[model samples]
Target: MSQTTLRRKFAAGLTALATAAGLVVGAPALVGAQATEQGSSASLGSAGSAGSAGSGDAPNTAPAFQPAAGNENPVGFRNWLRPGCSWDPVASWVQLCDVWSPAMNRHIKVQVQPARFGGNAGLYLLDGLRARDDWNAWTRDAQAQRIFLQDNITLVMPVGGQVSFYTDWDRPINLGGNLVEYKYETFLTAELPGYLQQHFGVRTDNNAIAGLSMGGSAAATLAARHRDQFKQVSVFSGYMNPTAPGMYTMIPLAMFDQCKCDPFAMWGLPGSPRWGQNDPLLNADKLRDIPMYITAGSAIPGRYDQPSSLQAVFNTFNGIILEGLSRGSTIAFQNTLNARPNQATFDYRTTGIHGWGYWNDDLIAARSAQILPVMNAQAW
Candidate 1:
């Protein structure tokens, strides 16, 4: 990682969308491809239920709600894929969850769960900020989906929620040392690749990483930034533009606010001349070269008057969604996606909000051009 700042421009932080389970979708059919994995769960969960994407079960996550046993077309099927041993950590099966970017200072973390069935390559799954410690979702949903993977790829899930944007951070937070100062970028770009080759025997020709929400944004940004590293990248209803209008309302103002700095200071604010720098919107040209999977859901308004200790913030969230996220995130995502004028492989649709059910379900339906290549290359 280098201290050099990202000199590009970006919009406002895109508004976070409600999870897909709550949105309205007539139900889109699954894509043409079927990724092999042990458990079933092609499509399952509560319809029209509101929830947060990364905050709950997005990719590598289980349904917040389940159906009757007989109707377990999705849940039950995937459950079968779960290892019989209460040893549900997918990281244990084969390679399990392994932290990277430490030794060589690389910026990528890999979740390589040992496949009970044995495989190669890997599923580079990403997570939202809220999903840092939940191994169940990674073990079950990730491993289950691999039933389609014939063990040819590894499931690379990087832990370390808040700091990891899957990219090198220019500065350190609170007391942490600067990753760039420690050279994390070199590790993710160089050392980690060699580690995969040495440890997993992966060829690295086309290892893929697909993610939900913020993770999606990371996948796209990383692929675009380091094009040669990834053969493909996919994003599901991602909050693409960190600087989309009314988007950053949740960041330094809230989640990372106590840290004392933000992308604005890291780079520059809108109209500051450096705005839009490093933004996905500006890097669309770089992304146009890679196979991309992008999707979004129409977030709906929800109950706002509920009592809470942090009533003001809760009301803020309500106002943000109703007046901001309801429309702002979408505009940000679309604007960025549209940057690729001639997309050879891409997916951009809105059938629901940002929930696990629909996010997981969208994975089922958006596979025509998303992550199937990695799965297909190995076969479930």
Candidate 2:
């Protein structure tokens, strides 16, 4: 039998899978290309809001869910480029913009997509600290596999803060001394979804969240908290246990050296909440219902494993070993999933690490049969 047929059979057999709008069990007529094909178009259109479309619960902007000409894929089908500007001006695939949250008391630079394949499914992507504002931050080789998402999902890359860990600092204020805190949680959950639909024409319900490294944990947390909003979630090399054994020491040191944050300033020393407040492990229950994908890899000694900026400093701490710590995320992730009976779907790979290569692979898997079924069913 063809791989697509297997996928269909397996998907059909997922009687335990979450409820979806459409499902063809046991070779239920394949629609798009498989992983090797890399380019396939899924059928989709506007769906009603699970909540309210473009309704601002906080300070937010909303986009539209309209599919346009030259883009047949709709939000979930096409993977086209959206133009965005940032610090000075440089042309790039991911459009970078700014978002201000009075609740957070900070101005955040966000990367937005006008529309990918004219589809309505939206994906909020996060970047690691050492990564630049220009790149998507997670899953670097997107240009190649973007075809998979073409007409399949809307890709939104948020230019993650330097060492922000995508967390809303527990402190009363932000790094720049802005008396207001960055309400990332609200922005991501409440505001951002509405904003995407109003501006880009994406249906809010037909969306999911995914990311790499630390961002992966953020994805888990969001999906868990708002499973009603997102149908699927994916994490590549995510931290399942923030307070994992030895992490309190190693993570702080790694942050100090690579992220350039005063350990005292960011986490307020070892016994502080700054470090552990947002670790997904602290709130594993929140992620129990969301379907997820996770992966990681270890570093090669003396080889360029991670981005130079991060790898250089982390290398001092037996970076290879630090890479090994990625297993911690995988372990914690497994522990939680296994504990629950069909809690959430997962794809965990022990062969990769906190780098772009692994992230790209995770993205592919998340977009594959494992995760896309949830996404496709999300269509109204």
Candidate 3:
């Protein structure tokens, strides 16, 4: 087929995939709306709970932690959307708030679904490798707003952290002649937390973090480094042992493929200590006593697989290989943690791949088994 025809076909396939998965909800939901402080009775399903003995069964009902009546949001915090800060409503109980990231020299968007009733507990959801600037995958693809609509924990989903691994890079990364600033570690751990606490009423220290794919490793690393900031952490298909044998070259190549960005700009060079420093496996010791939930699939086709079209087939193939690698690193990290009193939960699926569906499952499983229980946010 001609190149133009191929491009059109690929676009069509993407549209179909997005439509079938209901990823088009963000554009309409970005408008301003009002959210009532009420409790949610939403319950999780058993699908993500399948695998290990402690994978955590779905609770019969959501948590019942209510915030102080007049302290949900600061006075005049919901007046408008932009101009600095405000509670911009998205859905029944969701709001989009933007905060200034001094390091990045711009405003960063945070999609929030406040807990039913209100609570100081917050859950930060990180996005994958190709995270977009408009919205987070947790809310866009995984439908996190719907999933946690009734839960009593503020959902903090920060948008746009494409290939930086959500880390504080040594320097600015040049992506195809465009320099992109990545001070994510500082932004997430310090800047964002302060904003959430001051405006959203979420406690800076009372939080949990979860992520899929690339973001997964970031979640682990951040939680390990900033243990006081996070009570629990869950990694879905993350490459914990990033400094493992072939990864030195694999990461840079993947970065190049994604945006022609120089990986050296992230950590200096291959043998830089930052590489090992950022490796979740190397820093697993710091995660001790922190409620940990880690998961990776077998890479085989599973329920969410749809290899019907050319784009779908290509995606499935890529996902299988990626998940296979993630499984190896996940197992290695699990091994490092297993040497002690097993405080971590590992959910190794017999059949699955690296995709949003399985990551969504991992999120629900982590919440039920580890996150909520550890944060005292579950009603089980």
In terms of lDDT, which candidate is strongest?
3
Looking at candidate 1, what is the lDDT of residue 265?
40
Model 1 lDDT tens row, 1-380: 11111110111122223222232222121111122211111111111111222222122233432212332122221222221122234422333334355543444334454322334454566665334334424334433344333333455665444423445444443424343323333555566566665555545554676776556666777777676677777776565566654444433342232122353343334444333544566667787666666665444422322223232223223322322232345355556656556453444333333344445655555444455564455233
After superposition, which runs of candidate 3 have C-alpha atoms over 4 Å from their true positions?
1-90
Q: Rank the candidates by TM-score, best first.
A: 3, 2, 1
Best by TM-score: 3
Q: What is the lDDT, from 0 to 100, of the residue 362 in candidate 1?
A: 52
TM-score: which is higher, 2 or 3?
3
Q: Over 4 Å off in model 2, which ranges?
A: 1-94, 104-107, 114-117, 139-149, 172-181, 262-277, 298-319, 343-350, 377-380
Clashes of each: 68, 41, 2
TM-score of each: 0.60, 0.64, 0.77
Question: By lDDT, highest first, what's the ranking?
Answer: 3, 2, 1
lDDT value for model 3: 0.67
Model 1 alpha-carbon drift over 4 Å, by segment: 1-61, 64-94, 97-109, 114-120, 131-137, 140-151, 175-187, 248-250, 257-277, 301-341, 344-351, 366-369, 374-380
